[model samples]
Target: MGRSWQGRGRGRDMEYDKGGDNIGGASLKKIETEKGVIARFVIGRSANKGDSMDKSIDAENSQTDDFIILDNVVEAPEEASKKVKLFFAYAADRWDAQFYAKANDNIYVNMDALGSTLAAHLGKPRAYIGCMKSGEVFSEPNQKWYEPEWWKFGDKKAYFRHAYGEMYVITNALARFVSINRRVGSKKMGFQERTPLMVAAMYGSFGVLTYIISTGRSDVNRVSSDEKVTAHHCAVSACFVSIVEVIKILLDASTL
Candidate 1:
């Protein structure tokens, strides 16, 4: 990989303590691939007025404000492939962009790298997309491609399971990714093909439910390919009482 880095805002360099906590105003972490591919890593706390880091950390603890930059990464040697995979796995599962405030400097500085890296990895594209959405990676929906070629129709259903985990909020990034990848209406996930609506409903993500329904891409009335579950069925069975509005949205969309 190339050694050149285009540094953005000025940041202080602080060494990691034994426990791996950043001691200064901002933390700097460097990721070096086995073949010696190194990239800049920087994380900043969110400044959104009402956003809390605690609230974002749920049972799964899947979110973080850690904005990372890999766009400067040129190319990796063959030996570093495994290291790259491991890094993506850790980043996707541990530190997503869900709870961060929009327009933060860390995110703004590395938007292109963030989007490109997330889209390249298929193992947890949803998680990657969640992070990107949290950062508002793209101002317009059509500016980027968020999915890989392997994400066939039924794959999203399997992927939807991860959304229920902590830190995976229902952001426009998720919706936009599904729309662009043409996985919005897929029924191929499991023994029963659950649409995006059912997944959102089961996960009790009202924002995702509303957004998918508004897109008019999901078949709100269609039952699962095997289980015969509709979005309403998922809502009722999943006990999504907190989002009764989702039920209403699904109901209204069905009539149109």
Candidate 2:
């Protein structure tokens, strides 16, 4: 069986039936159907910037219908999309919702306003309602969001008009779609970042690091491109549960 998703704004919810994966772009008629990705508006922490990030900080950070908070998600990003993916699974499984969103632990949402916003989309099938953003496909190796398979595309700037990640709604239809075809989205985007494996090891995000290792996309012993350190060295430098779990996992993977 095939899976399908709907897009809000100007796009239509194209129905699929075990036929093809739509990865965006006209030349690539099929893209992988990602599962467990429903829809969410999230709270985020402000972090470093990629040079391509737009400079209109004032317009982006302002409160609007798209943001569940006072800032656009792209500006104040959330924790990794993995965490939000899990949130989508849990919320969709346990409750019946027209749309779902995620906020930081410290943020509060107005239920009344959210309910009203969702009301407009009740009839929209598989509707994902969020402020859509089209970002550059980072292709350079060892950089953040570097799509290892960038050569598949004719041009990065061209595909920007197609599929994007930041959707913010989920209905029964969307949840069922996720249940059927969900898997990890980015195969290697963060795997070779400013040394993400090392960052995860040092920051005590053992869970994130473990997933990276499990993918067979990372080399535990390889030194980072940016920090010039191995995962083991970063694990040793960290002070927390990471010193135990991260180190052991790294050692085990290194031997394997």
Candidate 3:
């Protein structure tokens, strides 16, 4: 495992307290394996802005010499054998190019600290799955807006139930079949429309849980939308299934 420190801003100097804790310094730790590496970073309050910690940890793996960061954000159908850097961003800020430029010297942030924090949550003999949820803003159809329903009995219940069941089945089956991975996603939607960020944040947890359960070695059904069936976002069911499959492959390879 490799460790590093990172922080936010240019002018602020990180100060260590009597407990030897840096106010802004965030610590990073990378778990290296022959198949891939999972790098997690710990950040203090100063660095917890948006999804900053998440992006930074992803950057470590994406920025590495051996791995290839996909140009397309759209999920792909086929799985690749290349090593992956699964980043868990605990901080609230979005990690942009500017953050990467100052990754090496920010004293207030210790990346290792962040990694340790996550490790505690992950527990020993760690396993996980990667389930992703599109932000509510992106999922919203402008023309199809309606007031939130208290009881979605007719079509909504059926839809949510199916989604929930599928998710449960996939996660549970994958966990039973595989080993040593993480899974995550959001099971519910937030009430507020403007605060779509909360919904997006849920995806991280969902993805971790999905990954842990799938473990990169499970049978996944292809997503499709027919006349009788409709997905949350028109044609995203297949995309979701495919992503789970990809994680399954990655986890399987890692175990090998």
Candidate 4:
């Protein structure tokens, strides 16, 4: 609860937009005791990534100076691993902080509960808390989640699972680890068997579908292996989240 911020990869500063705790209509029980923060509040400014430091959004807590920010960054978990490395590489200004936590939007964190959990590992300099998940990687070429330099694990099932809606926490030390030391690998181009628009329509990945369509890369009219099956066909076939929205997006993309 100090200054808010925005940031991207390492060596850049971030600035957070202050809209109070409630965003849109979804609000969380306002947190009082503070140790960690919502990762979504973190953001970046400035085109120049040099000096790696910039400005901070004025959060509620004026007395304490804990939170920091960054520069230009993609959406979460895209360059997320790099964000971790950047935070760690950064030295605290004016004060000493024992821990740095990562939390973001779509969460209602009990700061008291989180504080107690973090207290147990207070003295340990390099302590890690929360769940660390793998096998979260997918090699969708034109998709945003694809990381070309995935050298953390051997082959498939290497990248940490990325759920855009899923909110979790992590410590400063661990986030800097593999993100900094991992090697880079050659990205092999492969043919996509199915259309993203079709797949997104079939499954209820509203965000992914919207992004793909916005890029104008998805061929909504393109048929699948069956040649007769189009994205519209898939949208109608699946009774998942309202097909109306998916169809609307497909139709809109068609006009573009």
Cα lDDT listed for each candidate: 0.24, 0.31, 0.24, 0.29
On lDDT, who's better, 3 or 4? 4
The TM-scores, one per candidate, come to 0.18, 0.35, 0.21, 0.36
**Which ten residues in a row are the worst by lDDT in model 1?**
206-215
Give, for candidate 3, the lowest lDDT window spanning 10 residues: 190-199
Model 2 regions lying over 4 Å from their true place = 1-79, 103-108, 140-148, 157-167, 184-256
The predicted structure with the larger TM-score, 1 or 3, is: 3
Q: Which digits, one per residue and each the tens of the lDDT, describe model 3 over residues 48-144?
A: 3335543553454454322122322112212111111111121112221101101111111222332222233332122233333332222233535
- Candidate 3, TM-score vs. the true structure? 0.21
Please provide, for model 4 over 82-180, each residue's C-alpha lDDT reduced to its tens digit, 9 standing for 90 to 100. 443343333222113444443332122233333444454444444433332345455567867775665554576474433222222223343344234
**Highest-scoring model, TM-score:** 4
Candidate 1 wrong stretches, greater than 4 Å: 1-76, 98-256
Q: Candidate 3: where are CA atoms >4 Å away? A: 1-67, 71-110, 126-154, 157-256
The most accurate candidate by lDDT is 2
Write model 2 residue lDDT over 72-173, tens digit each, in one string.
Answer: 223222334433443454445554554544332211122233344445445554544332234566678988767776777566532333212322334446
lDDT of 4 at 137: 53
